[model samples]
Target: MFKQKYGTTALVAGASEGMGAAYAHALASRGMNLVLIARRKEELEATAADIATRYGVKVLPVVCDLAAPDATQQIIHVIGDTAIDFLVYNAALSFIGPYLSTGPSTHLDIAAVNVQTPLALLHYFGGKMVARRRGGIVMMASLAGFQGSGFLATYGASKAFDRVLAEGLWYEWKPFGVDVIACCAGATATPNYNNTHPRKGSFLEPKAQLPAQVVEECLQKIGTVPSFVSGTGNKLVSFLLSHVLPRKKTVKIMGDSMHKIYGSKWESN
Candidate 1:
């Protein structure tokens, strides 16, 4: 059922490694051909080759920076007339320190990668999906988006946009046979996450999930809900933050956790 509905070809942005690569592999395993996009050429091509070999499905690797102004056009140009049945927008930029420490350009770039590009791509591909009357979209959101995270302020705000966008689109597009979902993942063992060097024994480290686990859970829940926090622990935490706790308390909890993880690297503006 999954393959038949969304199996023709899937496009995974930021598919060079980590969760994006995992999404690509999962879709390929389900018999979907793929068009993988990322900034790193070698890594992207290597991932595409490996998936094609392992799953015996067509894989096209397109190297393009999602932060670029013309990212959506670049992807569309590369894919040509090939129809994309599913889209996984996984590209994101984050700054994990005092928000004011970074220059305005850095925050703008984060907004571009995390919010603007995804919105543009959704408008492009989502329209096609609605027209075809069959498709799916998975926008990678984050648990931090639930509140005003201290260090990840801008990134969280951008993800909040994605989460709401997906929810609204899910409602508007479902009638047209298109399934849109936002996978609000918690801490996962992705390269980008690991690069942050989260403090060991911190509250988030113990709860960190594997990329494959995150991707699998996301795939399972895509057509069932507009959005979901991936993982059992994450669900519990999300529930507490959103329902049980007050908004002020929720923001403080996230702020404290982020401070614990990246406080050492914090710089004064």
Candidate 2:
């Protein structure tokens, strides 16, 4: 198995819920123990208990707010001497509004979690993986990364950085037996998604997929490829946006969609 080539422990950041928890479940099912990290201590504990019960694998829940300044060090401290064979950078922050109108602090917080944390974690764990000559890294990116969207400018940009970083790491790490992949998924049916976009059906947009399905696709594609967009509908849309349409038009269309979703809050402070 792909996972067997790596060690027995996997660290999944943001594993209290959504796609993060899904990855935790998938990893446990593969007979790997888990170290789950997130800010929500209660949710993290609950998820840890459930996964441990179901899979009979050790599950440790580390509650560290990724937005906190010392998050990377806190996570490493919580991990202690556990050998993390797989690292999944899944925690993220989504701030939807006009970029200029948003506070600088908000942007910094988003950058800390979405961009800085991943790079720091990779630098710490990736070194170990290379030294051991076996490991994997899965970074959660998004379709928004492909284009510049009005309301989602910062989030999109952060994810784009993630995608490119993972692609580059895949090249550099492949020779060292470390698998790296950027799993870019679109409109997943996470609790956050259901809460945000309640009325689902849309002629222009594909239905949001289940978290399990998206995470499964990510795990399956990890060792085989550098990057993959999860859904079929997402793939087509991404292809058209990048290849067929003008970049300006793509951005405008995405902005219009976000406006529809966020309504009065689209560009308003």
Candidate 3:
């Protein structure tokens, strides 16, 4: 059965809504006090209030743009001396389009939010966890991380970095009683997913999971494994990609699926 294996205080980045919020709910239900971080103060406060009231656990909401240059510093300052037993690095930004056509600023923003912020948190908080000999880290990754995605080049690469980093950290920290996990999710029901791929049965659409399902699965596996794909369908698909398909075939299939979803929007050059 599931258990609360980490410390009392848990911090969740991108906790304003979607999967991040779901993670907060799961943790709070497991009796962990929350430190919620997100760009939207109102949304963050609302989520914090609801969770605090429902689970009877204290919730602190910190507003910060994770892509900002000093976001990690600001977050650390707000956290003060509280020991974060579990850290969920869930914030991410992706400018979905052909890589070359996207502006450099947007690309940098993606890198900052998806890569730099997580790295900073893991380095700082993870070090503390290692010293104390107990804690857990969950990095939100995606199926795109496993292969070269055509339209989502930057996003895919960034997720790949997250997945690899989480795995390496997991290996390193486990011996010291720290648990690190990469939650590689497939298409889930989110505002971003709905807006981007409006049609059904397109690539990841067929097996779309709920945010709650992903969070529950992630929580169950966090302390036990280095990584987990959120949904059953996603796990099966990941296994096939890993064991059955060659890299060329896998990349082609993923690229073709992406083209079907995004090709209509691109202007002919």
Q: Which candidate has the highest TM-score of all? A: 1
TM-score of every candidate = 0.96, 0.96, 0.94
* CA-only RMSD, every prediction: 1.6, 1.7, 1.9
In model 1, which runs have C-alpha deviations exceeding 4 angstroms? 200-206, 267-269
Error of 1 at 41 (Å): 0.7
lDDT of 3 by residue, 1-269 (tens): 22346779999999999989999999999889999999999989999999999999999999999999899899989889988989999898987667888789998999999999888888999999999999989999999999998888889999999999999999999999999999999888876677786444354444689999988888878778888887878888888887899999888877778777677777564
Winner by TM-score between candidate 3 and candidate 1: 1
Stretches of candidate 2 exceeding 4 Å from the true structure: 198-202, 265-269
What is candidate 2's local distance difference test score? 0.89
**lDDT per residue as tens, model 2, 1-269:** 85568789999999999999999999999999999999988999999999999999999999999998789899888778888999999999988877877799999999999999888899989989999999999999999899988788999999999999999999999999999999999898888877775343235667788999999888878889999998899888889888999989988888877777775644354
CA shift of 184, model 1, Å = 0.6
Two-way lDDT contest, 2 vs 3, winner: 2
Better of 1 and 2 by TM-score: 1
Predictions in order: lDDT? 0.90, 0.89, 0.88
What TM-score does candidate 3 reach?
0.94
Model 1 steric clash pairs: none
